[model samples]
Target: RRPRRSAGPVSEAESGGSQGVGAPLGVMSALEKQLHLGRLPPRPPLPGGGGQSGSKMRMGPGRKRDFSPVLWSQYFESMEDVVVENETGKDTFRIYKSGLEGPVLLLLHGGGHSALSWAVFTSAIINRIQCRIVALDLRGHGETKVRNPEDLSAETMAKDVGNVVEALYGDLPPPIMLIGHSMGGAIAVHTAVANLVPSLLGLCMIDVVEGTAMDALNSMQNFLRSRPKTFKSLENAIEWSVKSGQIRNLESARVSMVGQVKQCEGAASPECPKAIVEGIIEEEEEDEEDEEGGGSVNKRKKEDDTETKKEHLYTWRIELAKTEKYWDGWFRGLSNLFLSCPTPKLLLLAGVDRLDKDLTIGQMQGKFQMQVLPQCGHAVHEDAPDKVAEAVATFLIRHRFTEPIGGFQCVFPAC
Candidate 1:
């Protein structure tokens, strides 16, 4: 008979002893030493140019480059931009292009993020699929300018996407596959449900839930409420970010994304503008206080609560509020819309760092196949670029409308 084991808890020392002597010390010693102290040679500063090399540098990591023609040559060949007007007359859609011939992929970014977020993925897709990729900077974000306040709504944003698509590739068959993150994902769903574009091969939603403006507002309220106290200066903010491990392991491109959020001059300076920083601090405090105190208020009231509202309106907050209205309508009509469309869809659900799991579950039940990326956070593409790339490639290959001449018919071609 097997010896009866005591149902007792194990202590750390006992556990360590069981692993053999000196294991803890060896582990500690190894961790104490830096692994890459002098392993990597310094990279040379990139050369200046307006074409592909510059664009490649701008695009940053996890992006593919063809070396046959050289990095610079390929980069130059892939760089182009066009300005398309939003149908709602609220924004100018700045469309950046990569890849020459192939199917079209429209990449839309999430709230507080720009099309530049897709730069790495765009580069990879362009090289791998021989497909044209267009990344659009939505209104009030990145280089895109919002022309009208009304155009900020979700429906209008979806309309803007349709307009830009028609304007750029109307002549061509709808060689478009929609990939959207966060807010962009919502817009993509809206566009699909509305049947704004013909022949949408697939829709990929990255980390967004189906909902209305109220949901967005609630999300923002929760986010603001959970934030640490605002800093007195910009340097302090950066320092805090660095110390908190937020910016420590981030790539240069990711750092650049944060840099774009710096609004005031001398933000990098030690003597940063107190007024600007204070305004941010005050707004966050007010938001937290209001939400906690059960004060039901709209954007105008929230703005009025801040002393520097006229001078330093948080563009992010305003944009969020505008999006909330659209989300409200979307949430109400989501079921009917999903039933009506039933288009093949890919939903990349992050396994970590998300507040709502039900949203993802609901999507899965609504005929959206979910790929739960283990150990990934809200920014699935950024956190796991290789995995994302693989998934994207597989998706494209599976649903590819255009067949390659004299090429493999299936991913798993029969022997």
Candidate 2:
């Protein structure tokens, strides 16, 4: 039987405390500090120039420039890398497209994550399957640029997704497979319900419950209200990651990823001007200050900023605390929204973890089918990449879409 649903809303602090139980926050904080500091690699001198003395030297046209395709080969294989400028002019997206012969698959990443999250899986799937794949970094994340926080709303986000889709296919095919994780999943649902993308093939949501964003925002606001202090240095942030075991066995990857997102040179120095990271931290600080007795207008603006920032942290520990409660309303809304779509859908649930089963089952009723992946957790792709690929392959094949060369065999044997 499913556990009884809590009668009232749970504060983000309480939720975080529940998850952080037996976990040492102090040690983790220290480790995170170190990870943050370790991001910078040894810098190489620029070609045709010496250090400092040749800092102003510029290479003339027709000179052979460094085009190290190796660095981006993984993400561009079997796909065309293109940039689409949105009508708003302030926003643009780096998109990767694969396949021309088969149906289209719109791949979306979770919040705070970029399109790179789908690199490993998409590469494998594209090789075997004959379907087109369009992976996009949602606005305010990865390569996509957003000028205003108001653009982070569900409607706006869905429009961004729609814009990317329209740019690529141009109304060529109906029933496009829409797959998203975390915040991306919410945006996918919103787009499908809004009829932004027509002839939806199927929807696959990874580890995100419906309406999880608002709950997460409220929780984060409360959590920040409890404590608001900047880290002394980047090393402190790395140390926090280490002690928290957020990266676990993949310390280097974790370090690299965090470095990609948040890092600035020299200890105790000013933070860098990366818009997304700055926006997130600034919003959090504003929320903290507002809760300490700001005026109504200031509080409302801070609240709006908090919601925008929450979307960027959707896939990480910063947002997980609120997902547990947020999913209830989220899934309920999705249950109603998805009913309008004619395509058969699939819900990949992590079987091993203790999730809200009633919520899961309730949301899938009539509108979609569910598949419980045993021994998997929230990051289903990372935990069981092969199984996820196989499930996706099979779903496409069953729907009369082109199947990959090897058929729908389980790639991850353990899964």
TM-scores of all predicted structures: 0.59, 0.57
The lDDT of each candidate is 0.54, 0.54
RMSD of each candidate? 15.3, 20.0
Q: Name the lDDT value of residue 56 in candidate 1.
A: 30
- Give lDDT tens digits, candidate 1, residues 58-127: 3443443221111222222343444565444434566667766777778888776666566656655555
**In model 2, which runs have C-alpha deviations exceeding 4 angstroms?**
1-70, 78-90, 173-175, 211-332, 352-366, 407-415
Cα lDDT for residue 382, candidate 1: 56
Give per-residue lDDT, candidate 2, residue 258.
35
Q: What is the lDDT of residue 158 in candidate 2?
A: 85
Candidate 2 residue-wise lDDT, 1-415, digit = tens: 2232333555656446542323223323456535633554555676545653223233553342221112334444443434456565645676666666677778887655556556556656776778777777776665555575324566777877787777666876545889987667777888888878885778887776544434445465565333212222333333333333322222232322332243234333333222232111222344456677656645564565455432222122232333344334334565456555566666676652433544445544544655677665455654556667777877777667776674545342222
